[model samples]
Target: MSEKIIFAGTPDFAAEHLKALIEAKYNIIAVYTQPDRPSGRGHKLTPSPVKSLALEHNIPVFTPVNFKEEADKAQFESLQADLAVVVAYGLILPERILNAPRLGCINVHGSLLPQWRGAAPIQRALLSGQDKTGVTIMQIVKELDAGDMLYKKEIEITTQDTSGTLFERLASCGAQALVEAMPKILAQELVPQKQDSALVTYAQKLSKDESPLNFNHSAKQLSLQVRGLNPWPVATTTFDEVVYKVFLAQELSAEQVALLGKIDDLENGAIVQVSSEGITVKCAEGCLLLQTIQAPGKGRVSAGDFARSKKDLFVRGKCFA
Candidate 1:
């Protein structure tokens, strides 16, 4: 017999796993997602991605603020689900809810265990320039993401990957990983391994303050920052007293670095050169070629195009603070 599952999650990441489970013919008795919140410019109440998917599948949905209320716990207990699958679920499940399922709750976390064990793992991995990251299937505990691992699958972190791209990839990866692990889980053939507490590193949530590009960092670091922040709180820098958002950037080549070295008194964050390829800027360690950028109230365009239209503003020696 197939295991009965109670699904809990909120965002697109969570919805992807639910879709995978549904496609695999898992018995999802009900779904628990965060309450609908005001979204977009109009501030209209919007359902979470998981809720929308659950509704489409005609699965029962619950949006409890928390399980602190005895009624909420009672309602969950009444389901008597054999298992619970959680992915990017916003709310913390109390111990009662965690133990309610016969097989307990398992989480599809977007990072390798013992590292990036908190929220925003995808963005954190990109910002840290990790060569790779992956999904971890683990038994959920009371502590935040401090779970016993059942399975993990790694994927390379390409230089060109932005947080938005990585997010999509990991979401799909997590779905596949969960689907593969579920059979072993149901058959009682999988053993949960304890994570080393010494290797734990938390991924603090992203903040608006981290959006500004700091030229003091190396070009490689700045490039990673720009990529990691894309699609949300995008990296920005002030050039000629105007804030411009950076979308795509790359570290300069050895030839370009030598060319920049020839320029006397080159200061970090100063415009180095502008060509058909892109706009190059000096950095603390090397140089960065800005491929894509967006000025306030303007659509994103190639740095070369921006330079062509605003040549005076991008002249060599102007610094981006």
Candidate 2:
């Protein structure tokens, strides 16, 4: 109950775990998060979710630029922590800092280990159309997410789950897994299992280039892409040199697919009507019904509003090009 714990995290997902540890009566001595960075349209500096939560709980917060630095490692060792709990901390740990804690470091990873073992795991999983994904608590190692598994909890990836939606669910489940495993970990009853190198896969961080809508892909793939990239670097299409963000979409049915006679005829990114849904022109595939969209310099609005604003732009057979 009184094991001095050092918590390292940066995002809301990590903050949730920190909250759980505190609530579960663990001794969280200090919290470490990434440094504040410029955000929003105004580019004002914003504190990370973990840092904000730590401040609220009156926990000492540390934002070392790099843990590999000697000074940072020294400062971390000074904590004299029995265990270091890390969740999406966004910083790599060196051997020195890893050994500083008496019980070693443990991480709450967002995906099943040996798969999706890097940043943007939740998004990558959804974008890849995986049927399910889950959390894994592991002992941190120098290798990237190559740590040994301590405990894991699985969750289904539904057809409608987005990165934002899945993130909140896993955050809660991950927090519970971490809290439940802490005692077992401290008592040395939980043994860490080495991940299989053969099955190792990386969930590379999302990039702006991945945001643009590619019509050449299938309707289902496009739908998954839209969900995975929602709310950031949103799946977008260019129409009249203006970018239209696709926030929500769905795959076309066979009947609707039949209506899209020739892809080239439909205006690329142009609005289309199929089976009572508003779809967008894609190069080689059936229309993708866009449920929500945001135009450049404007707030998010329904696809209907966007369609109405450019009524002529959305007629059937008009190609986006």
Best-performing candidate as measured by lDDT: 1
Residue 124's lDDT within candidate 1 is: 96
Clashes of 1: 0
lDDT of 2 by residue, 1-321 (tens): 788999999989899999998888888899999999999999999999999988888999999998767888888999999999989888888899899999999998899988999888889989999999999999888888888899999999987788999999999999989888888999999877989999988999899899887776777888999999976778887666777888898887768667766555555445456233455555356667787878878888888666766776666655443
Candidate with maximal TM-score:
1
lDDT of 1: 0.91
Checking candidate 2 for backbone clashes, the offending pairs are 266-318, 266-319, 267-318, 267-319, 267-320, 268-319, 268-320, 268-321
Worst 10 residues of 1 by lDDT: 259-268
If scored against the real structure, what TM-score would every candidate get?
A: 0.97, 0.90
Worst 10 residues of 2 by lDDT: 268-277
lDDT value, candidate 2, whole model? 0.84
In candidate 1 the C-alpha lDDT for residue 70 amounts to 92
